[model samples]
Target: MESTTALDPATALEPATALESATALEPATALESATAPESTRTTESSTRATVHRPAGPVAPTDAAAVALRPLAGRAVRLDPDGFLGRWQRRNATETLPHCVTNLERDGALDNLRHAARGERQRFSGKWFADSDVYKTLEAAAWWLGHADDGRLTELLDEVADVLAAAQREDGYLNSWFQLMDPEHRWMNLAVGHELYCAGHLLQAAVAAIRGGVGPRLVEVATRLADLLVDRFGGDGRLGICGHPEIETALVEFFRCTGNRAYLELAAGMVELRGRGWLAEHSVDTGLGGSSFGAAYYLDHMPVREAGAATGHAVRQLYLEAGVVDVAVETGDRSLLAASERIWEDLFATKTYLTGAHGSRHRDESIGDRYELPPDRAYAETCAAIASFQWNWRLLLATGRARYADELERVLYNAIAASTAVDGRHFFYSNPLQLRVDHDGTEEDAARRQAWYKCACCPPNLARLLASLDAYLASSGPDGIQLHLYSAATIATWIGDSPVELRVDTEYPWRGRIAVAVASTAAAGSWELALRVPGWCDRTPTVTVNDEPMDAEASDGYLRLRRAWREGDTVVLDLPMPARLVTPHPHLDAVRGSVAITRGPLVYCLEQVDLPDGVRLDDLRVDPAAAPIPVAIAGLLDVPVGVVAHGFVEPDGEQALYDTRERPPHARRPIDVLTIPYFRWANREPGAMRVWLPTA
Candidate 1:
């Protein structure tokens, strides 16, 4: 595999330089410098420079030898009128509060309270219950910055106080460890998840501080970090977290506080992986049966040596995310190279058509290469979210458009499909094919449910959607690049001048995107690059000021550079023709099958859309014929569905074993209807298939 280092670093925006220049221009004596124009305003400190001025909290501070930089969350705001806008609003108004209620109902809050009181009784729910509360708190913190909800603020503060009070003097804070069994604390390193929960707490603390929610959580996180460093750093202890999460969180904590110790500890943890530490301390007990060995926890080989994705899908992805963070902050090119190799291997074999990963229902592990079985898929919602997180870090580290493309695919399909339209219920496992009359366990229900005992996917989806704006656009020294098309207003800097751009479009349903320059400084000139999706076969046409203009394309983007004026409009037209897609021949399950996709949304045939007397299993799609587009009303709240021509092959043999060759099969024309994969099972639970055999 080629090393990621081979890619040119110049393509990525040099945030450190941009931030340093902004800081240097300010006169020390001028008090107004602090409130200078957004373009000229430097970050709080010159030593800690941010890439794009984030509209949200949690900006990355200056680190050595980083690749790409992210735009400030505050610089971009959704228009509240686009496809993403509706989802964001739902996440804020409904999902955030609903998650809190579930947490309270599930005893997450009660466990914290009980632990704070030094109770010896076991807490309800899983061993990772405290982490769920912290995740919900993290989502709420981000939402507080986007929307003003006084009641939510009160809830956040109350939760923070309870968590702070629950912490031990030594900074240890795991409810399961305190309330369930104190003697077993840190003893079960193979699956204890102590550091994993700490990672979530640290992330929640960072979110709180950055969103202006509070500082108490920051203090709590710092004490916990100090405790971790004292325990794991240097010769004190050499074992890393069985679950890989704290490494990334510790790096963020270092960024927020400008503490080198935290950064060092994060790097140390990454280095400690693949060292047989877990194997040395392995005990024969955990969630999965006897198969839950060292490899299942990703301890079989070192991170850099492991060529393909393995073990638990979420754990591996989270570990890779932390590896990418360490590589960027510490300039570990070898580590980055390892991550790139793993990414290539994952896409080549492990990933599913819906951009979902993990195939083993037994342990939520990534099955063998090309071992994707649709009927028994264990594509957990948390794994999909983790894949998105890892891809986002890779995009920031490499400035590669492919990373953004994969992230977009996962977000639109796997992540979006995990939740219901109302944002209340969720799917813990998203399978491409759901058989009729299938008996599902609690976690693998055929339809979305209000809540689950494990309940990780609901809050995880909420947090990702609440912070979705940050993943839309990115800025560099040359100009701003819009990764995902959305209706939003961006307030960012082009060099030293402030540039405000308003984007208008009904994306994913239409192909046209219109971007207008709302405001800009006098004589400002910067290149505005728009991404041309890899799936688009037709050349995108661009027009400036309503007149067609020739544009240059490079590295998956069309570069438009010129001085801008108010009311100037640049329009890009991407053809939205529905196309049929097929998997590699090596994929035995879907070898001769094909799937249809329009725009970024993957379409699937659902039982609710099929005509009566026609079962989904007996149908075969005609790949040669064009699918008829039909406008359907009130189908999973989607506006349209596709009708494809196919044939049904009914079995004639009544005997279980047909020794003689079956008579010539009769083919009859049938109309097969498909809705967006994410919208499946919203109406009723039945059979659904993403890939159909061609007749």
Candidate 2:
């Protein structure tokens, strides 16, 4: 890939004319002058009363706060011998490097350099271009943590140097506003995304610090955060970002540095939302009219008053994540309750069968209740990522298996579906059904692209896949809860006693999992909880030390409490049977259509698997007939394929409208091969559908 320095600065720096109004405003002050002295700022001990860290990936060891469970961190290692291990290896080896190359190729690096040079010119990409760089850095940090790659370490240092140099004296770090129009920094709060960029930067810093790389990035992020605290609060500016990602990022920063000021700032941002700030300051700033109005940016109501998931999907998910973070850290029941309500609303109405969120492609917003359209669905990949983030936080707060289930669904189906097998190309929008005549322009591309102009999903996917280990399990008072089964080993502390467990399984491909108690401190008995996925039709058969044990499941976990000696083993068998799933009656587009799902994988039929002259659109599955199993190698990244009995609707009179019923369709036993939904569109960009019409 070409270097960002190769780009001509003069040609790339053409300033957007809309920013001309910014010249009249006052310039920002220096960081030292803007921020309060260290002595005056609240210390970690002093602020612990108002806000305490909750147990989860954000605050892994803060057990003082009231949380249902505690999350495991980098201590849980994948065995590097299973399905997810293969993907993780690919992510570290291919995806992370590809993202770095894309960042340079797309001018993200140049934007920072140009801004640091005080060049008032055109920005490289969108107003949120800085976020892509931060996400890539985060992915690199996670990859480097697992693998000792000198190349990634060098890249991180190089990027951190550019970011540190680009930082303003007063800690303002948005390249777009800095290089383009510094005066208009916080004026366009509705769509400016300054804080959104800062949020990603903060997250990158946290990841880098935790991964033991790029301490300079941490300094840059903390400076920017301090600047934010000094500017946007009671004594400072009384407004929040148009986007809602910074709150969660700040909370993580506090967890990393033990600085309570960051936590308070995050909580304040959460509380400041839904106060009609955006609605009151609505102005036509050439970013298009807020057709959905303030609600589009989630400013219609306060975070505590919001009911349903609405507006932009990614924005709503990110905002809810912040809400969950603040609620958990501050022990705010109302905020958590509000988040629960939104979760219920989303699953009840807007969510798709493939665990995808959002409904409308035109506005990138979630439509009304029960308004999910398969063909026109706009399930953005970033929305899935945000959902995963929110649900993971929720799981930690409440210790709910449903939340973990939702996270697993989003991870396996939606998140996995967005990226190609090769890990280079990605899908920005994942629609349920693709037609032959569907235009590939815009977000509805038939196949994944190397990179999108928006370019959010690629790096987001990278970071998630790189940090997959953190989401696997969590430790509770009773024992360790294995949420997602895979070939891995979990090393965590159970009440100050070190415990190590080795789990071996084929997982989604096979339901048999064997977990062995490798080692533990000599002490009392600890309960081991294995999640029995809600998708299983029957109870999971579990055995302890080769003895059949009947344990009642509570909150989706089958607990086994016993004194464990080294080498003790537990085996769980969850029946993996392919089943046909149907949509609700109100979903008129796919009411009678059935989707195939086995284990956690949602299956779809593709045209590439059909015989020659067989049209995918004309096919109908026989609901009563069983789908024959066929071992097909390299068909949509799966080891097995299902040959379903279906019929191709014979061509009839091509008429726009017919008063009488159309001619009877000829019944032919056509073989329709099905593959996992995530693996679709990798081949010829042909027609595909998750829901098939029943014969």
Candidate 3:
């Protein structure tokens, strides 16, 4: 039986209707709504009058500036039985509760409590411990918007009250600073994370207001934001944080309230980057900091002048997300173009086959071009989440299928792989390969843990999963566009009429999509756009009500325009064939290897799947024999296992280096069984390799 907490749009818990009440909390402000000219202002009050609430976290005020507009959070929902829906269920039932428990266990909650009491004591956990609490708050706000859970709701109310108590009169509210170092507030811009923490608090506040939660949290965050504007706004301090989270968060806050100060502040911070703002500060060897100069903090060069993705992976991606947000809001074309160039460079030379980033484990930074190494991959889980966020913003900005493609790729492989099947454990860093000789002793080993000292990835995953349905599809003036396919119901307004659609599919496993138009208020002409995934090399077959209708796809979207819709179904068949993918020729680490893929799921060979004594390093797959799909029962019910023909190489253990000579030993033929990359490390901890050597 489905859990009682299953997210149903019919339930009264739906927050979309809660926006009208929440809008009362927004404070009135005289600041300009945006940095754009008077003719192009994208203020919330003037442009987005029809939207009941901001669409998810990346809502842009001006819908005309972008090609596609995201549906409001209460507008769409995922079916409880679908793949994403099941994961979201796990997130709510297991992952979110775990985070709440850990937050209390790890002293995060007490930190705020102690601050509220004005008691002086040593700070607990990392300096950024407050961020975890804020992220969980955001997740709870979103979940409460969609479903009603007594425990989570109570927790939200309690946290808001505590935050309100702890906040200083002037609006500053970092627990670490309040408890440990109040005298040095905002002194260490490079490593203090003051702005970063403030950004997350603002994000949580935005989620609360949009999710139809209480007003106290929003009031507290507003005070802090006002303080930030006073301290760092146009005529104030000229600095940028070592982290890049504040810019995007400020923009969202601006969208939630009609405060133009937030948008201009975010834009100014983005413009301040790459101008050596943090060069004078000594290198702080912290979790995300590095000794690799200003680039590690994204302060090496002007964001517009930077040609390729550089420095820490999460910082780089987060900065890009903020840049895109600023560009869309301010009508700055150059910033968007700059982000596009870096994105192209990233995929061309930096990204791994599993859509993961970060190649160096030393500083948790993306390595130089073509420096990818599978065994040494530092694909931090937070980086993958950051990448997904950046892609979503880019998708909204350009309405390009390629951005959606990357979003799907990372969600299925990297982001999904971060959590265990049970959802209680998580991986901080995701490497493509785990060598057989690996001891699995370090935190970055092939095993997932219940919690970590950093603990950033767990809560981050919680928030992403909590609000995932918002990314399923989007709407525009003409009609709607389906980006990620799954079993769901989407209802949104197109002009003066209401359009509702029901999508049925077991996507990434089976590709037959049946989009049934449940109802439409208007019988006039309107269009429905469906994305043709970039991974599908074969032509997709589309039909309207069982009648084949041929139409060329434009910009990766197949559009169908019709005058009337009632009980009309559109079926799209995308052939799912297992294929081998090779890396760029310049990637020397995996030069002679290929990864197995079907649909968007990347496949890998695990030690448990091999015969006794068969080593992953000694096997070579034959690309000529195509991979075949077979039924499996371990991970997901709908997914299938892949089988490929391969042979074992002769033993070469005699020497580290040998002369060029052919061995006489005969090779052993074998049938290699590969499972989805996200499913590995679930059964047992052992060798796992995504890119297998190909013959």
* Candidate that scores best on TM-score: 3
Better of 2 and 3 by lDDT: 3
Question: Judged by TM-score relative to the true structure, which candidate is superior, 2 or 3?
Answer: 3
Cα lDDT of model 2 by residue, 133-209, tens digit: 99988988877767788998898888888887888898889998888777777777788888899999988877776
Q: What's the lDDT for candidate 3?
A: 0.82
The superposed Cα distance between candidate 3 and the true structure at residue 525, in angstroms, equals 1.4
Model 2 segments beyond 4 Å from truth? 1-57, 60-72, 282-289
lDDT of 3 by residue, 531-606 (tens): 9888988888899999998846888889998875778999888877789898888999998988899889999999
Can you write out model 1's per-residue Cα lDDT over 1-695, one digit (the tens) per residue? 11111112233211111111222211221212212233332222222222222234334554545444566555666767667877898899888889899999889999999987888875889888888888888888777767678987888888878878899998889998788777767667777788999999888877775566756776777788888877877745756878888988887777766666777888887777877787676453443223587777788888878798899999999999889888888888899999999999998899998889999998899988899988788999999999998988887788788888898899889988988888898989889888877899887888899888987888888877888877788776668889898777777666666667778776776667888887777486788888888788788788999899775558878889888887898998786666789888788878899898987889999887777877888899989987654555655666546667899987666478868877887879987777889988788678889988888
Name the runs in model 1 displaced over 4 angstroms: 1-58, 64-67, 282-290, 654-656
Report model 3's TM-score to 2 decimal places.
0.91
Q: lDDT winner among the candidates? A: 3
As a TM-score, model 2 comes out at: 0.90
Angstrom error at residue 128, model 3: 0.3
RMSD for each of the candidates: 8.3, 12.3, 7.6
Model 3's number of clashes is 2
